[model samples]
Each structure stands twice: as structure tokens, then as C-alpha cells.
Target: MIEDKNQQRTQLSDLGEFGLINHLTEHFEIKQSSTLKGVGDDAAVLKFENKKVVVTTDLLLEGVHFDLSYVPLKHLGYKAVVVNLSDVCAMNAQASQITVSIAVSNRFPLEALEDLYAGIQTAAKIYNVDLIGGDTTSSTTGLLISVTAIGEVEDEEVVYRDGARPNDLLVVSGDLGGAYMGLQVLEREKEVFKVNPNNQPDLEPYTYIVERQLKPEARKDIVQLLKDLKVKPTAMIDISDGLSSEIMHLCKASDVGCDLYEEKIPLDPQVISTCEEFNIDSTTIALNGGEDYELLMTISQDDYPKIKANPNLTVIGYMKASNEGMHLVTRADTRIPLKAQGWKNFND
Candidate 1:
């Protein structure tokens, strides 16, 4: 909410467009053999040889998708790449390359972009992906990032949302609802800061939820773990929207319904406690709270033995005929129709 008046700031105009791009990307190293030419060329050149390729792209706006007051530029940059890569992972593929493009207002200094690129570089190194090519330009808006991620997978291993069948088990990786609760905490703190600038928020109790909102990691490891366990999902989707909407997506795509057990939906202790403090239902947050980024899929019942003992996976329900309809089976033995009340930007 406040900027230091005495701190130095460098304008972006001093380096121009090309120079700025070069300066930001100079430290990015090419780690993938699939990348023939990266960064400097007219366009990135990639050869996947005999492997099939998967491409996923996402655009995030400043005001619409993020708030600079809360989100650090580095985390924003890292998250922009991770979100796209998660889509590739949803297809059961190995992420190999990414192209990052950003539009920013002249108010951003060159150092600010350095922080953003540093985060991008860190993600590239940590995820073992190559930063190939992208474009940068001026903008009237605060900041926006567009990332296109490229991944490689074998033809037989590639999974789609239409492969789920009746009698398959619904499973999810990691927990849910933490990210939404984290956002709630941040929003509350932001309001408090507005009232009193000297009031420093004590976020010690909300550390898990805050990190969930700020820096979310894609489930790339789960993809590899599935391969090692010799279990391929029948239908898969990342929980970017909300559990209900994503579940509905899978059901519609595969033409099958589901009976999601409320008790079985994985949620962290932090989420439950925060929900109590805010007077919101934990189950509702788990269903409609978006940005969990966990993997949700249907697995053949025969393959259930493989993932059963794994703590990372949970079997929450089973798929049924579409005529049966989608419902959430409550703890008291009530079956309620599921609804998509998650993040719908267009509605706003």
C-alpha cells in the first residue's frame, strides 16, 4: 500500500524492448535436448523425435487474476509457469519447455522485471524445463503474463478426460481448500492494513494457507509417481477451478456420473480451523474453493490396489452411469446434487 520515497528506481525505457528481453533472459540455461534453438532465434525450434507433444497455455491478468499488493512478482512469475505445466501433467506428460510473454506498464522498473525473471529462471531449473522464446511489450495495464508450456509423452501414455468409465474410482492427489482459505486470510489482512498502516499482521498461524495462496506447486511429481506405480488414470483433470466444477467437467467429458463422499474429500487441518474462525463451512470450501492445483482422476477399480497404500492418493468416490446423476453423499447419508459455484470470471 506504500512505496519507499527514498529508494532508487530505474525506468524500463533506458534498455528498450530487445535489450530488456536479453537482459532478463541471459541467465536462463537450456537443459532440454529437445530444444534446438532457444531465446535468440526468430522462434524457438524444438524436435521431439518419436515422442508425442502436448501444449498448454494460460493468461493471467494483474487485477483480474492477481493483486500486486499481496502477490510477489517472483511468486507470480513462478506460478504462471507452474499452472501451465500442471495442464501438461494432467495429460500424463513430462514438461520440457516453456515460452513466457509479459505485458507491463512503464511504471515497472527493470529491477522489478529482474525479480520476476529470477523466479521464472528458478522454476525452469527446478522443474527441468527450457526457457525457449517469448515476446515482451508495453501495456496500459499493471501486469499480465502468458505462458505456453510444451511437454512430451508416449502415445499410449497420454490421458484424456473422456476415458473415464462407470465403476472407476475417483481419486485425488494432495489436499484441497487450503488455497482459498489462504486467500481469505490475505484479504482480511489487506483490509486491516487499509485501516491502520502501522498494524503488522501476524501470519504465523496462517503460514500453510498463505503459502498455498502465494506459491502453489504443480503436481508433476504425482505424474512420475503414477508411472512408477504402473497405474494410468482413466480420466484426469487438475483442480484449478473447484472440486465440483472439475468433477463436473470430467463427468461431462466422460459421460459418467459420480457419488463423491463428503468425508473422503481430503482437507488440511489449517483449512478446517480457518473455516471455523470465518464461520464458513469446510466442506463448501473444499467443493467450491478454487486454485488447489491438485490432480483429480478416475482410476480403474482393478488398478486400485496399486494406489491404495499410497498416502498421496485418496479414493473419494466412484463413477456411475450418467443417468444416475452427480451427487455428493454427506456424512448423514444424504445425497445432494452437485453444483458448479466455483470461479467464473465471466459472471463478475
Candidate 2:
């Protein structure tokens, strides 16, 4: 029998903060050996051996970062954790632990929060990261989530954004623009829903793009693949804020220029179709669309041979001298200056 989602709704006041915390986190077991001490303590105790530790944190707000009307609690929780882990992977590290803190208003039922934690637990299991400790608190308005991911990497294996040189090859893991296209689809459906509450959305056609936006997987496998291929990236960053924005970040940090090939930028078939349906430029979408969570890295020219045959990666561009200036070479051979037009959370 199908479970009724609304059949059992418990108020937040039914379980106080402490009781709620224990109830939600009871299922998480310690799986990481680095975790000396987990939950139910003043603080989490961790021990990293000889390798260097890397920590990354992210804050997700209801209206600012996400919309509950379309985003399910579970997917939000998973995405929240995955985004932080993506940062760790960008450094060529293995994420081992996470601390998830959440604040929710009284409007949310205990079951809703359980759904959120279910997603978090699933992400922790799949990513192989232990949820050590976190805090649960009350919020006056909407829900909020904060996640901190910790990982380890050898000193020599750590990759930074400022290491790209003039001759380094710019490579990207997976295609871009699908997530942004997915957001467009969701927003359109949301608008349609507002007009006709009884209408069901036909999301089957946009399943791939929708999943790209709602549940993005970090490039953890890409990191391991790079290691197996013996390809050490000179510089790297997770593509959270569009390819153009990330490329600019790498260029500014490394004091170099880039020549991104418009034809070479990868785009999923769904992304292309959606762009056409929306009357938007596919290249523009790829450049400015954000939240792909793919690894953007610069590898040495000598390492090109190793990655050339790798289906998981694509060489989109090549770095150049700072004096050359960053430009996008059009398919027609026209060189146009590249600009960052990614999302600005503060602009609205």
C-alpha cells in the first residue's frame, strides 16, 4: 500500500529541539575512521593522519538560494551536502565528513524535516562521508540549511585555482547549461501551476535537465579518474557560477588569458532542445548558466594525451599570456571578449 504523506503530521512543538535532533539524527552511523568522536558531544573530534585537511562550508536560505514550491526537501538536503563536497573535490581531495545544521519554522511538520534528513542521509551514504554533528534550531520564517564538508589530500596532490600557466589546457568534466535550463523549465512550470492548480506538469521530456538542477552530483569520480590517469591539474575549480564566471576566476587568479572555443563547449541534447524551445542561445547558456558542479581544471600540455581519450572530460580551451586577453572564438572564427554573466544572488 502507498503511504499517505499527509496522514501523519506532527508539530515541531511536540518534540523540543533536543528531542528533535536526536529523533532526526538517530540513524546516522559513524563510517569514517578519521572521526574520533561523532554526535552527542560538545564538539566533533577528528584526526587526520599525514595528509592535509580541507574544509568547505555553504549556507542555503529558503527564498534566496531555493524555492520550496518546486524544490523538495529531500533534494534540497542532498544538493546542500553535495555542493559543499563539490568544493572539496575541486581541490582534488576525498571528502570524509560533514556537519549539517538546519533551522526550520513551525510551519514545517516533523515528517517534512524527516524527509529532508532522509535526503541528507542518502547523500552521506553515496558520497561516503560521515555526518559527525550538527545543530537544529528554530527559525521565525523559512527553512535554512548550512553544511560543512571536510576532506583530505596529500600536499603535493592539492590543486588550487591560482596555478594555471599560460600554456595550460583548460578542461571541463561533463556538459554545461543543463542545470540552468532545468531551472527555466521549473520556473515555467511553477508559473503554469499558479494559473491552473489542477494541471499536472509533463516533466518526462525534461527529466535529465530537471535532475541536473534539483540533484547535481559532484565530480568525485572525476577526481579519482584524474588520479588513476596520473593527470595532476595545475589549477582547478568547481563550476558553481557558470563557465564564464569560473574561467574569469581562474584567469584572474593565475594572471593569464584564455581562448574558449564556442564549438567545443559541451552541451547535453536536452539543454540544446530546451534552449531552442526557450529561444535562447545555447552558447550563451553554456557560458553564463551556473550550478553545473563539474570540475573545471587546467592540465599541463604533456597530460593532454592521457585525457584526450577520456570520455568524461573535454578540453574546451587553452590558457594564454595575460597580455592576450580572454576571448571566445566563435564558430565563424570571430574572436569576442568573454564576460561573466552568471547569477548574482544580491542583485535582486
Candidate 3:
């Protein structure tokens, strides 16, 4: 995130609020037919006559949610949108539109915001979600982004965290631990840069994990894949706050206990190798390392056959009676109580 000494700087106050909004949102095209009125209005207009709608909002602060030291504005913009879309995907819904509101300090220039909006537009186009409406205002803080994602789902197709039942098979989309390890790599490089500014980081070996942290994609495909396979999840939640934390959330909401097999938790080769390099336990990283953005779900045993061969999904474990309690069935055949030690918003 190095800045050029001679780079052009167009002041935000010069364009004014309305001019800035219009300039930033001018290039965003409406992709969803449901979006009747997009940017330029006080509030967005959307229509979903028969289908059920799902709305999710996420607020990302400058220092709290992201550190601009290593996080690019464009990547931050894209990540802000994807995080909310991941929430929609967890509901088994099709994301149709999003309203992005940003608050920035006086130090930011118009071109910097253009780069941020460029990432937002790229995400909107790739996800096929329309940019509806939002508010922009001056902030004393660095930068804050709040994205509200709206999605559509069939009335009966909508899944919740409480639909899981005893004996249901636990499933997860894609591998874990990469994002957390990637963050470790970035944080290390950031520290290194402080000590030696001219020493360039050799991140070639950590490309996969690094990308997993910087440009993670929401598992929107898993929802459609389940529909195509005629497999409806009994319960669903996206893996944002780590696997153990999300599993506990699902289990508590469903009034059931889970046996998350340690052996079954998917770990990419890069994640495993990096964990060893860091001298950190891979299993612990998989359990507590947050922001995977993969979908975690439960399905009936009857539906297992349909997804058994699919490479996109991995059957991790099974649900049990609530009295049995949530636990991790270790590789050594030992059972231990599962704990929620992932991301805490109010942590001091």
C-alpha cells in the first residue's frame, strides 16, 4: 500500500457529497431485474413477488475489521461485499442486490474512493448483484464500510441454523485453516517491513494461503449445487467465525449436539505445510482461525448418497442428542468439549 510521492490527489470536499456519490456510482450497472431503482434515490426499490427475501448487513471498521496497512482498498471493498453475500449464501438464497455505505476521513482523495468503488463494482458484476442505494458521509476515523446484501429464495428452500436434527450428517464446503495462516503470513511480512522497508517479501510459496486471506470467494455455488443434487440442508451456517464456533452456534440453535471428527476437518496442503512452518497445530488453527467464508451445513442421512461423490463438499461429522453435548471426536478416539474461541466483536 505504498503511495507515490507525485500521485494525483483530488480532494473529497472539492466534489462535495452529492457529486462524489454520483461520480462513484455512475458506472455501476443494475444486473438484477428486481432492482427497479438503483443509486440516485433516497432508498432502493426492489421487487420479489413470490420468492422470499433475505437481508443481511455487515459493518467493517478501519482498525477493527481491517488494517489498511496491508489490506488494499479494492480488496477491502470486495471483501466487505463477499462477507455479507456469504451470510446470504448460508441462508440458501440467491443474492440479488447490495447497498454499500462508506465513511471516510479527509485524508482520502477522490481517486482512492474510485479504486474502492471499482472493487465494489467488480464484486457486484461477478456476483451478479446490483448496487441499489446507500449513504456517504465524512468520518473522523480512517474508513468504515457497511454493506447490506439482499437475496431471494424459495419459501420452502430457505435454510436456518435451527433446522438440524439428531443423526443428521454434518457437511462443510471446501477446506479450512488457509485464511488464518495467510493472515499470519501477512502479519509477519508487515512486521518485517517495519524493520526493513527495502526487503521485499517473498510470498511466492504462500500464494494460495495469501489469496485465501485477501480474496476469498463466498460459497454461492454450494447452494445451487445442493438444489441440483436434490439435497436440502437440514441446517446451515457460513464458516466465518471458525469451524468450532460455527458448529456450536448451529448445534445450540438446533438443540442438538455435534461430534466434529478431528480427522474429517478438511485442510489444504498449503495450510498444513504453513501450520508446520509456524509451529502451530493445524487442528487448532482449523478450529479457531476465522474468516474461511465456506458454508457449514447439516443434511439428512438419506441425502448423503447424492453428495457422497461430490468433491466440493466434505462430510465432517454427525449430530447427536443435546444431552450428549457438543464435542470433538479426536483422532485418538478421545472426545473433548468443543469451545467457542473464535472472533469476538467486543473483545478488549
Candidate 4:
């Protein structure tokens, strides 16, 4: 029996963003002595007196984070590790080990599990991280993977969201927006396949970009390089939420402002061409398109030469006083206030 819609309950939109977060999390409280802070920042920080530990976990669902139709089991396994490791790297800590938990339905066979484990082993080897423990369980639905990563750092070496100082140079590792473009290419091909299954996708043209999306290499090397170079980023975050959103995080957490240049945002030639092919603004893609998994950070101006000379790094902008503003400066010399367009699962 259908009820009167006019007499129905309150909508989620009526609660708004902060209201939802508060309502959902209000019931939970930190119960562990080691838990320094929880669910309030980029990553949960824990202290053990002599040393500090950073803990982060991520859950990737079958249809949401990936589509098995196009993604290989091996790549899926590796990506599962990469996503969690990316978070540890963002905290400016070296990942040491991971615990992988999988929940799979009866549809997946033993051979498929072996293939997935093989990929996980490969990623563990590549990152020099140990797979210490995990849990395997049955599921009523599709595949679900959860990974919890652990890393250690000296109490002084740990960097958090609330550390950015004014005048720091905002930098990022590698290029941006390639992953979004890659997804666009894959989705277009999937549509083509739906129309006609026999048509082979010309994925060769987008190998690099597609790989960027499918099996991204974690920026573990960059974290190691920063340690070797003795450059501690004032504040740091990863690019999973799009550049605009991440920049806002750094600003809000650190009580600072930022000025990012449109031109300085790194873009590979392939990404530029792909954006043109799709008739989308590359700048917009870099700003709001998510899941690049690159490092977004700020360093001291004196440390600029260190990051500047490195081919792996790109100086895209600078931090400013909190009262100034956070914005993007276009090539036309127009300055527009920055805004976050982060991806939302609920909205989709």
C-alpha cells in the first residue's frame, strides 16, 4: 500500500552536508587509548609515546570503485593496495604493511581468488610492504575488498592537515586529470560495446591514460624521495577528491589560503589531446574530476629549488594568509574563488 507523499519523512537533502555527517557520526566515540583523533581529519592519527602511527582504511566495492567487465582481477588486486597506500603516503609516512580482507560470493572460483592474490603479492613486492594478515569471508552479493594500512613515523616527523603556513608553495607530484580522461575513454568504449559487442575497443591509443585509471602506481617513491631530500611539506593531501576540494581541505585545516595558477597545473600531452577530443576543458577536469591519486602538498618557499629541480614535482600554486582567499588564477589573468566539486556517491 502506497502512503501519501505529502505526509512522508524528511529528505536527506534537507539535512545538508554537515548535518548528515554530524547525524551519522554523533553516536560513535573514540574507545581506544592509542586513538589520538578519529573521523575528523584526512587520516586518523594515533600516538604511542615514543613513536607515532598513522592508520587508514579504504573499502572498494565491485560496481562503485571498479567494473570487473573491463578491469582485470590482477589490476583490481594491485589497485586495492595502491588506494590505501596512497592515503598513507599523503600523511608523509612510509607504508610498512597491510591487512587485506575480502568478501566474495560463490560466483568467484578458487582460480579467480588465486589470480587476485597473485596481483596483491605483486603490489606488495613492488611497494616492499608485507601482507601480515587478513580475513576471508562469504558474501551474499558481489566482491568487496577492505585494506587497512599501518605506518610509523617519529613524533616530530608526522605532518597533518593543520600545518600549512602562509607563503608556502603548493606543489603536486606527476600530472593531473589523465585518470578522469581515461575513465571517459573506457566509458565511451563500454557504450560502443553495448551497442555492438564484436567491436574491439581501440584501447591501445589510451594505454597510458587508461593504465593511470586502472592500475595506478602509488606515490610511495615520492614519499621516499622527500625523506631523502629533507623536504617536509607544510601540509599534505592526496588528489582523490579533485584539486579544488583538496586545496580547500588544506586551507580549512591549516587556517590558510591558496592561489593556484591554471597554467601551472600539470597536464600530459595525451591528457590535453584527450580533453580536446572530448570537448571538455582540461582545466575543469584537473580542478574537479576526481581519482588522480597524486600528492597535493605545500612546501616552504626556501624548499622551492629542491622541488623545482625535480622532474617528478610541479609547483602549481602558493599558500596565503587565511584572510586573503583561496582561488584560481586563469591564463586570462582573472582570479576566481576556488570551490569544491568533489564526487558524491549519494548524488550519483
lDDT of 1 by residue, 1-348 (tens): 423343567899999989999999999999899999999979999999899999999999998999988888888889899899889999999999999999999998887888889889888988999999899999996998999999999989999999999999999999999999999999998899999989988899999988888888899999999999999999999999989999999999999999999999999999999999999999999999989899999999999999999999999999999999999999998999999996668888
lDDT (0 to 1) per candidate:
0.93, 0.94, 0.93, 0.82
- Please estimate how well model 2 matches the true structure, expressed as its whole-model Cα lDDT: 0.94
Worst ten-residue run, lDDT, model 2? 1-10
Q: If the candidates were sorted by their lDDT against the true structure, best first, what order would they fall in?
A: 2, 1, 3, 4
The segments of candidate 3 whose C-alpha lies over 4 angstroms from its true place after superposition are: 1-6
Better of 1 and 4 by TM-score: 1
| True-structure lDDT of candidate 4 | 0.82
Clash tally, candidates in order = 0, 0, 0, 0
Runs of candidate 4 with Cα error greater than 4 angstroms are 1-50
TM-score of 4: 0.84
Number of residue pairs clashing in candidate 1, backbone atoms closer than 3 angstroms, sequence gap of 3 or more or interchain: 0
The most accurate candidate by lDDT is: 2
The digit string of per-residue lDDT tens for model 3 on 158-241 reads 999999999999999999999999999999999999999898889999999998898889998998899999999999999998
Worst 10 residues of 3 by lDDT: 1-10
Looking at model 1, which ten-residue stretch has the lowest summed lDDT? Answer: 1-10
